[model samples]
Target chain A: MRKVSSASKNADRVFRVATGVAASSPVVFLVVIALIVLVQAIPSMKFNGWHFIYGIQWNMGNLYGALEHKNGVTAAAGASYAALPFIVGTLASSIIAILIAIPISMFTALILAYRVRGVLQWILSILVELLAGIPSVVIGLWGIITLAPWVRDNLAVWLSHLGPVVPYLRGPVGTGLGLLSSGLVLAIMIVPIITATTRDLLMQVPILYREGGIGLGMTTWEVVRYICMPFIRDGFVGALALGWGRAMGETMAVLMVSGSAMNLLPHNLYSPISTMAAVIADQLDSALTDASQMAVHALAELALILMVLTLLTNFLARWLVTRTGRRRSTKAGVAA
Target chain B: MGKSISVTDLKAWYGDSLTLKGITMELDANRATAIIGPSGCGKSTFIRCLNRLHETSPGAKMEGSIRLEDEDLYTMDPVDVRRVVGMVFQKANPFPTMSIYDNIAIGLRLGGIRNRTELTDRVEKSLKMAALWDEVADRIHTPATALSGGQQQRLCIARALAVEPEVLLMDEPASALDPVSTLRVEELVEQLKESYTIVIVTHNMQQAARVADKTAFFLNGELIEFGETTGIFTNPVDKRTEDYITGRFG
Candidate 1:
């Protein structure tokens, strides 16, 4: 009979523990962050109930002259964060960013992933990665110094025409810190995330798919649009979700160029406003009243909401991936 | 030995390394021509070269002449050459993402048939010819991956046939399939030979013996013998061919 070894048992136990830790770490980290944000946000939500979310009047703290006390009511009483302006700012900037980024990023990613090769591919790939590596603050500063003035001076005539088409474009016409500025900055910030991931997805496609597509006599662009893109639509969506989340969470850059003005909504394309992040930066440190504190807490709640939205988007993309994965290499059924 | 596809001092290379050296043989059209050899003997490579699918790997180079009738396929466009000669792989590589119907339709669509009615007709005819129409007709709309191994091989055959190429190439088409599926594919090949010039590469001696009209024995990048299948199996003209068929060596 072979002797049982205690050493092997101990090694096996250690291996099991290590594997568990490796598997659970990411899941635990995500759950903990979500719980923390949600727990911190619960009190703010409890205070004003639905009224806090629906009410548009942001003048809670000083505007109402609410006094501080042992009571949490003063925090709820003072003029504080309203979802309306922050919601408008976020939607406006993100949409503008997507509009600008999607066309250019798609073209760039398509060129890099498919058409370009050799040294040019290497150089362009590096440049795109470098763009992603640049910090949000750097993008904001660039937008403020370079892009803002350039667009203001050169695009002034085009900017005026926007008002006639849309009610939101109604505003005093000067291109300083505004919706367009934050959006353009957001476009620059998100382009790399979208481009790099799109490139990776494109690369992961089997060479056979391209051959098969070409063998069928598809033109270069048609093959990409139909065969290549369709096969990796889920990945592109996943990249877009990441880009959108990054744009939503942006702080220093949007604040720098967003003008951080307390406004009801964008009356014009050049209308300056505060994003959720910008509001947090401006008000969190010196939240003088209880309502102001609640306002800060509300931004944290918004962060949780954004987290949930992106998580849901990721789930949708993952589902699509699995659906396609099932069919990649199956053979024909044997006839009975 | 089979249908005539004139080859003259043919050589193929991958980048700097030559894989097939000064090969010369005529492939008989309208008959199954089997090339049997060891794993790296370039039997599969030789068949793929026929279809021009060999150069799909970047830097794969072929020299000398591979004339399909009077026209040299190397001189003409490879895409046009590929369109003329269809290939089936070692593995039954059906596009799992596509439906059985769509899998058949894909090659036709690539061949530039825009009419849905024409695509549907061609898909049906090819499926029927491949002997897979009955089993798969009901589930034609279902994903190809949902099929059994034999069915997938037949589906691949149908996909190849859908384009209506002049010649068909198989690279161990039944190697991954079960015996029954292999037999079905072999039988399907016999039927396909009526219209298309058939070139097959098989490791299985019995499979080659059962189906091939001509057999070409290869070893270590060289063609040892090319003759009638009946003569090669029964009374091999070369000792190497005899040794290979008698189970003394691969």
Candidate 2:
């Protein structure tokens, strides 16, 4: 080995420290955000106690009303902040988006990875990625203008006919600016995310393994179904979880198409709803009008909740990807 | 039962370049035929063509008339052709996600043999045929990838055999193994020839001599000489065949 000069050694040390900081910046940022949100949410946490999550009411109260003191925190009289409706809305719409996205994304990923080739494959891949790059607010606008109307005039009406078969499919589809519209908009936003990630994962599957399936008399579809899909299972699930995080945290787009339903729960698939993210954006103005500042603290509490949820999902995705990656690497080691 | 294969004027191309230049030959049933050639000599491509695996590669194409016994190979569905002709690659490739039992059972299960007892028996028999039954018998539920490289190769062989193909194509199956494993695979090939028509592509001339009944020499994608292994190794009719067998040139 060549001996390193002291100058070069100092450079190496600096480089290592720099790279380490770059690598850990995300974790540092996450911790700082969590700490700040937790501190800001303390007042709201004391006032609401367990009711913050389970209570259905979410009111800023009249800002002109007399101030009331309770749980060592001051707020406008009759104020309440229950997040049950927003929690349900967030989960339902995101779950609906996931349900609608999985199959479509998988098939699209398959075509991108295996079916098409050359210029067509390149073009399709770029187009899919371009969809991901499009502004979410633009998608929200499209949802308001075109998707909401279609849902009201077509999808909701057609789905209502199946009301006798499925309980959630019942009539009273509303103005179409609700759960179904929010879910559809979210699905469109997440499909490109899931599809692009899945395509990359599918493409990483070794040709040798695929050839083993093909050589064993499996049809092309069978090869994909039995071999390719199973090989990429963990990575694919990680992609879905990543997309789930994005859907849950999405604000502007979901807010626009969500019909901004507040203080109530959706009774059916077509009923209006509001996610935690949408609620934060939609209620901030009125929340700021509360002179006691309790409303702002409550919004901070909501941010804390959203942060924790997204973090959990992101951690789940990382864990899944690492688990599969370690297994694949070990397998490769043995083979080599 | 093993089926004979006959080829006439087979030509293959990878994109615009021709790799196999109109070669023709016949392979007998229930015998191991060794295709000996250097790297890039189309030995592997020729076997890939038999199961239509060659066409699966991007820009790869072939022009050939190959008959599996009385059946035209090209006319049959590629999937059906692959069923009658299974291939083992130069590198071992057992499905990493599967257990040893599942690895062997996959081909059969997908082929619609869902009876549990039948699947178990076939898996056992295939493992035994590939000479991997004893080592892996107790640990059949373990991941197939946990096995050693040579065992994984045998596992792949067993995977192919479980499908009950009439012809087994080994593309340098033992090239990646140690001396001991190579000898074991050669012995397995000798044993397997009693039931299946085996076409083995190898760069090792001694391996061809040990396991093959008939040997074909491929150079620049042409069938230079083909005859009894003993005769080709000893008295080659073609000068190029003698040069290759005697280690004069690839």
Candidate 3:
């Protein structure tokens, strides 16, 4: 072997360090954000204890009152913060979004991946991705002006007929600016995301496998159902988890449509609600006004919870992708 | 029962570039017929048209009249034609997510065989016919992809056999295997020919001579010569066939 040039060795070392830093940057940012949120949340954690998650009431209480000390933390007299309603709102709305998004995205992805070709495929794929590029604030404005009214006059009334089958469908559909609207907006936001990911995955299935199904007398749909669909199952699931994380963390659109209800639980599907992400944005003004600063700390605690939730889902998505990817690689040969 | 195939003036094209140009042939019942040719010589396209697998490709078109035991294969539903004439590809392609049992059982289950005992029996029978049951019987429930290359190819044969087709089309089925595995597949083919009309497209002349009772030579998208395997190798009919066999030119 020829001796390595000193300049080439120096360049290689620099390249390795640069790539290493690039790869680790996301982890560094995540840890830093998590640490800052935890430090800010300590005061609220000490004062609120377990009630922060289970209790529905969220009163900043007498911002002008004398300070009270408890659990080594100081706050306004009579101040108490609990996040049950926000937590429930976050989970319920995101779950609804995922349920609504799955079928629509899956069928769209299938069509995009297999049914269309050439210019048509290009146009449809671009249109789906364009949906994702729309600003969330613009979608929120549309939700308030167009979607909210339609839900109140049309959808909520029509669905209330199912009250006999599902008790949650019972009437008393208020102004549509609430949980259903928030969920719908979030669904619209995440559908493009999941659909794009799924379409890419479907396209990646080798033609050899599909040919095997076709040669076996399987119909076109049968080939897709039994072979193509199963081949991409794990990746599809990972996309769903990633979509769930996005829906949970979304703020601008959900905040505008969620009706910003506080200190109360929704009794029906149409009831107004507030997610943690939306609440953090909605209450920042009022929270900043508290002389004791407890309200700000409580908001930070909410941020911490939201971060953890999204982080867990992202990790789950990566784990699922890698696990299934390893299994697929094995099929290539013994060397894999 | 095995079925004979008569193809007349079968011409196939992918987007105006003709791949199989007006080839007519007769494949006997319960006998292995090998189509031997260089790459791009339309031998693969000819067999794909037998099972209607050729037209599945984009821009693929074929003008042909193929009769399987007096039933016009072209007019029949493509799916039905495929059900009667099963195909094994050049490379092994087992369903990655399915177990060996599920891989074999999928066709039976989809064809509406719901009885558990019958499914198990058919799976076992198909695997045994492919000469793979003895090696994989204990791990039949494991993922089909976990098997070796040659074993996966055999598993694919078992999958096709479970459908119980009247004709079997193999396109260079052992080209990707090791020498030992290739020999095993050749032996399996000799056995399968006893029950089904088999048409194989092969690049290896020796493989064709070993496994095929009759051999057909293709060159430049047309059939140059076809005859008994022994005669085609030992005696020369067409100048092109002689050249290809004598290693003068493909």
Write model 1 residue lDDT over B1-250, tens digit each, in one string.
1235777877788788778887899987798899999888888778767767677665788877888878888887767777777788776656646788988887677667899888899999999999999998888988777888788878888988888888888889898888888889999988888888898999999999999999999888789999999999999989988998998987
Pick by lDDT: 1 or 3, better one: 3
Q: Predicted candidate 2: what Cα RMSD to the true structure?
A: 2.7
Candidate 1 or 2, higher DockQ?
2
**Residue pairs in clash, model 3:** none
Candidate 2's displacement at residue B221, Å, is 1.1
Model 2, A1-336: lDDT tens digits are 998999999999999999999999999998898899999899999888999999999988878989888989988999898898998999899999999999999999999999899999999999999999999889999999999999999999999999999999898999999999999999999999999999999999899999999999999898898889888888788889888998999999999999999888998899999999999998889888889999999999998888887778678767867775525434632353
Tens-place lDDT per residue, model 1, A198-253, is: 99998877666565555443456766875678677767877887888778778899
Sort candidate 1 into its docking category.
Answer: acceptable
**How do all models score by TM-score?**
0.81, 0.95, 0.93
> Of 2 and 3, which scores higher on TM-score?
2
Which residues of candidate 1, in runs, are more than 4 Å off? A1-57, A63-72, A75-80, A96-130, A153-177, A195-236, A267-273, A286-292, A311-336, B1-5, B75-77, B234-239
Better candidate by DockQ, 1 or 3: 3
In candidate 3 the C-alpha lDDT for residue A185 amounts to 97
What is each predicted model's overall lDDT from 0 to 1?
0.78, 0.92, 0.92
Best DockQ goes to which candidate? 2
**Least accurate 10 contiguous residues by lDDT in model 2 chain B:** B241-250
**lDDT score for residue B101 of model 1:** 93
RMSD score of candidate 1 (Å): 4.9
